[model samples]
Target: MAAKRKSNKKTRKKKKQLIPPAFIVGGIFFVMVLLIILAVINIKVKNLEKDIKLEQSKFNYARQIEKDIKAIFYDLEIDKSFAKHELIKENKKILLKYYLKLNKNEVDTLFYNIGNLLKKEKFKISYFSENELSAENEFIKIVFKVSRFKKSANKTNKEMYLKNKNNNHRLSIIIDDCGNNINLAKKLASIPYPITMSVIPFLKYSKETVKIAKQHNKTVFLHLPMQPKTYPNTDPGKGAIFLNTPKSLIEIIIRKDVEDLGFIEGANNHMGSALTENREKMQQVLNALKKYTDTFIDSHTSTKTVAYNVCKSLKMKCGMNRKFIDNVDDKNYIREKLYEVLSLFEKYNTIIIIGHLKENTIQVLKEELPHLQQKGIKITNIKEVLN
Candidate 1:
């Protein structure tokens, strides 16, 4: 019986050893679970990095696209109303793609901006549609209309202008210093009215400016540069059409300046402080101008210019600049100049005012010109004033 008791105790000790091995197995399983959890965490961190990189790239691309869109809208606004439809449509496509790819709120804002920009360009929105997609986003479809002017001023003589039924006064604005800026010249050309363009001769852009002016059916004139007191240190251009130049030379220069720009109905002096003061020089210029059956206008840099005398002698159409709109380069000054022109018109029944291609001058003209008719004022071109 003593031997049987000892054997049972040894068997219990063996069972205790088996329990230790089970505990070892459980520790190994715990280590494996820890390794699996670590691997999952690494994979999740790498995925997050990739998502961030992709989003950053998308953001950069969207910013660049937005820049391009804004530039296009600026062109449509500053460029002429006669802008190419294809170009506008192409830009619209790019804008649409970028806006659609953005979130819904961003897309709506883009369309709203576009609409506002178009309104400033004198265009009216016809209709718009938006579609919601599965990405919880929407895309906009925009349609716009360009408003038309009824009886927008074309070229008119005094009689024809007086007979027009449109209430807007006939102010024939002639913009000078045009040849160097083709885009701006073209923009001016597209104004539908008979605004004359006075291009400086021999500029790199002169031919193109003339072509654009012709395309818009606007009159083209040579902004002839005479010897001005302010420009004593500089020559105007090659073969400068100064009043002091000989009659034969003047004719040759004028002919060359008008080279294929089409028929030049008239001309205006650019700066003629020296040329206008010399009666002999004025006579030479007048003689040369007589060949083309065209009119002449003096910029009137000097009050003593012989331009009126020459014009009267030749029986040719003659006009003089009454006011310098942008000489002081202030809005109030320009407005005062315009008001002075209206006052002069009231007194003389016809008057001409000279203006340069400054932004302030354009802005003032746009604001003030529409109200001239209500004040019983008539705005006519230099020719009408002469006749």
Candidate 2:
């Protein structure tokens, strides 16, 4: 019986050892499976992140392409207007060349859209070419040469009509108060259009403004200061010719003003409300301007201006401002004023528009001047307008 009990205990011990080994093997298998599953999941997450990044990059590229297309469209609109006026009204041939760094599809789209726009505007396309260019680097070069057929009419009548029409319509723009800032004057002069720069005499930048105006082939005028209705409260600045200035003194001041402001083609009152209304005062100023061969422009500061009559009596070449562009210093308002000038152009066939060196005025001119040129409006100097 003692030996039977000992054998049973040994059997129990063996059973316990065998049970532990089985549990250990199962735990090791579970850990291996978990590690393999985690490795697989990590690889999938990495692939998903890369795909998201790629998709984001593609979206950004598409947005940039859209923006570029819109910009190209706007530029084409301006070019089309210019081409139409030159070809249809002026009977001139225009060759426009554009270089763009764009992909093949974008280039093709640009040409197609331009062609359609021009066709819609009744413009006959005389020449068109597009190809990949390698100057400096790879870019797309597009050339468009356009013209219009002249109407069949009696040659004599046609010549007479055209001659009269050309002679009648003229527009002059004068930018005043230019001597205060030389940099602004330089920027205004750099514009590739005929505009008159009326610099205030004896201002801080008066000489520098004239120098830059001449350098850029811009016409310069003396923005002579005269007393305004507001009087001392609205001072026109130093060297102003007031209403109370004596006739002799006025003549001396006028001549000195012209002499000091070298390279000026004409003189226009700066703020001559009171002086312009005083006939005698205005006559003295206009008479002085005659000796210098400098034309006079009545700024028309006062509705009761006698400067115009004085100029006529003195036989001085003169013009009057029909519109002031930046009275409100608002873009929309200035634009409306410009359109008013255009309307005046239709009726009078000649108009002079004056604007200050304000930022809004410059912005409007930079944007709309090209459009004005596109509409067959001539931007001329004060001399041409007066003639």
Candidate 3:
């Protein structure tokens, strides 16, 4: 009986050891579950906090915009004698007209401040302008229409102002490579409206073309030649500046070219596919032009053009060519291009178009320019269109 009891006691002790291991596993599992639950709860709390912070930021921004608007109104009231606002309804659209007896700088600053505030408040903006700031000019008028959402109210039949009835679209045409032919230059100059002539420097008839262009009161531009993609196969002609040319030599050549083509209001690349893409060469060329010309027109021959950016960085009056009018040299194609110009004008309010000195271009311009007046399209100068 004693031997049997001893064996049973040993078996009971083994069972107790198994029980302790099971308890230890259960405790570890509980601890793992608790840690997972705590982590999930912490993530939810962080997300909730982030959402609340975002809402608070939006509210603060709205409050700031309200403050800015109130300040603007207060300033306007203080200067009430010098400014006036009128509301007009046209074709169911509410328009605001602001007439102020302030200089161009003041008007610009006021408009800029309000526009910036509106933008910061996340409002869509469509801006257009007729002219730049002129301090010598008299009172200026500002007009705008705002909408909260893409919703429209009831339509009403109302008589619109005469000025608003006509679309105020302007187009500036530039004839490139003008000095190649003197007769073509004269024909272009006789078109009456402000057609710019971009004369190639050092061409056989360069000086004569400039004289005829100036005599007819047309603006002249130096069609400055530079290295093209097809350098040896297709030359940019005499007095062309190259990418490898030293900066000093580039400046000297540009100055001489401008001198050769006198009475020039601006300068543009003739065939600068390579040089326009070279920032260093373009900067040298534009810097040299600053001494004589008032503006620069980037032909934008290549997609990688740095001319416009360089000009802007230098604070120079610069414009970009929207389209080539006579690239095909066909009369019908040129006419189609001019029609495209009209379409672009409808969208952009202003467009700068370039064409080479081709006979077909001349014919098309002579036929189409007269009808622009009938269409109420203004032929403006290049300088006026430059930003």
The candidate scoring highest on lDDT is: 3
- What is the per-residue lDDT of model 2 for residues 1-387, given as tens digits with 9 covering 90 to 100? 999999999999888777677788999999999999999999999999997776566445434433443443453333433322111111122222433444322333344334323322334433322232111101121243323233245443224334434545678899998999877887798788888999998888898999999988888888988875544434678778987788888888877887677767888988765688788777777777777765888877655677887887777787887767654445775675676565454357788888888777888888988877766668776788783
Could you give candidate 1's per-residue lDDT for residues 154-207 as a string of tens digits?
532233434443433345567777777776776676554567788887787887
Find the candidate with the highest TM-score and give its number: 3
Off by over 4 Å in 1: 1-171, 260-262
Summed backbone clashes in each candidate are: 1, 0, 0
lDDT of each: 0.58, 0.66, 0.69
Candidate 2, residue 356: the lDDT equals 83
Off by over 4 Å in 2: 1-168
Q: In candidate 3, what are the lDDT values of residues 148-231, reduced to their tens digit? A: 122124321111112233457778989888887888888888988899999998889999999998899998899998886545
TM-scores for candidates 1 onward, in order: 0.53, 0.56, 0.57
Comparing 1 and 2 on lDDT, the stronger one? 2
What lDDT does candidate 3 reach at residue 86? 60
Q: How are the candidates ranked when ordered by lDDT, highest leading?
A: 3, 2, 1
Order of the predicted models by TM-score, top scorer first: 3, 2, 1
